[model samples]
Target: MTDRDAGTAEASARPGPGTDPDPLLRIEGLRKSYGDEEVLRGVDMALDRQDVEVIIGPSGSGKSTLLRCVNRLTEFRGGDVFLDGESVLAMDENDLRRRVGMVFQDINLFAHLTARENVTLGLRRVLGMDREAADDRAMAHLKRVGLAPQSESYPAELSGGQKQRVGIARALAMDPDLLLFDEPTSALDPELVGEVLGVMSDLADGGMTMLVVTHEMGFARRAATTLTFLDEGRIVERGPPDRLFEAPERDRTAEFLRRLTDLSEDRDR
Candidate 1:
């Protein structure tokens, strides 16, 4: 069975006309610009609870910027981001960050800290938990990512995949309502990619609400509830992954997927 099929059997029970009735995240007329160059232009989308939305696009298509805007890591010049009916822009930055966790492309672990320490830092500092409590929480999440054995190891001692898993563990430790992944596997070696994707697949099965920007089409095909294509700072098309991958409605969307497929084949050869 496909990974999505294995996990999404329960998704049909969610409350919409076809999906969830209430959106957990809603973006309306979102726009972002760097100096004079607009990166995102009038983008609109909504993700239901437990939905895994995968964004794919060519470089410079503002995919990363869109993810950042959702978490307020990058401020947008125009539009609104709402999570669970509350405006994200109006929420306190720390509180908002706590509610929305992010796993970056480059695993941003502290070099001086152990994996456990890295995971516990935010819990102890932001949530103001006692060390013992923080440690317990950290270890639990590390174990979830299959990294409990490496809890005492520093980032330098970990492989790229391990480090990324630690990053994921750190994010999960926050117990955020939503998670954002910005090309989570892009920095890893080809062999290391599967390990991270496997963890992500498990998260999807476990019903984590996630917004991900990735070129990992296999994972997208298997785990995403929706696939969105962005180009020139706008969403050109979006739908279920199977339909988008097999028969994209837009010429641009079809061409983009074809190029990605060709690139994947070339890399394999």
Candidate 2:
């Protein structure tokens, strides 16, 4: 971590009279490896309430692995992750997932279920809500994503963007303290990317604490309060989006961002 990052983390951890001092999410000395390949190497990060932290990196840089470790979707080799001061590993797996909802690159909605049903599965099973109550809550979240009318449609009947939005509504229905998005729009058609990103932008604007691993520079520039550059299982730079883009403190960060911008421009052409 940079000196600026350390100072920022410290300031964010200090509490006001009515606030809690601990960060909303904290990862310390996190390490993960698959056989001979180490994905994460002693990573540390912290996020306060309502902070949208966007993580950008190359394909094999451990960005997605870090998010998985937080929710225990993938077990780590070392270190700890805390949510609201509670160790995630100590918490029950179901409870950890409830507190930290994840949306993946693939929309994993059940083909047989409607959009509303997909959103309500957790509410009904994990949350133990009755059908009527779950339906009501599910519909509300679907509406928030501008998909209320499609509530009755199956995943097969929806566009890629709509399917991903349903995935978002499903996560939001859990009322997670932090949302993890791993390339949520990567599966969408180019024209469809905006709809999903729009919902994410809205979520960021509405103070949803998010840790997103995405290459969407537009969303990163607009929605992220803090931008992180991870490479080869390490954080190379951490700071505000403007600083990283306009004046990166590290040469590696500047080169990576420039390459990413070039790729995005080529994609746009």
- Model 2: which residue pairs collide? none
| Top model number, TM-score | 2
Q: Estimate the TM-score of every prediction.
A: 0.92, 0.93
lDDT (tens digit, per residue) of candidate 2 on 1-269: 45435433543453431134588998887999999999887677788899998999999999999999999999998989989999998899999999888999997988899999999899999999999999999999999999999999999999999999999999999999999999999989999999999999999999999999999999999999888888878777777788889998778889999998998899899
Which pairs, if any, clash in model 1? Answer: 15-21, 16-19
Alpha-carbon RMSD, each predicted model: 6.2, 3.3
Against the true structure, whose lDDT is highest? 2
Model 2: per-residue Cα lDDT at residue 229: 89
> After TM-score superposition, what is the CA distance of residue 99 in candidate 2 from its true location, in Å?
1.0
The stretch of ten residues in a row with the least summed lDDT in candidate 1 is 1-10
| Model 2 segments more than 4 A misplaced | 1-20
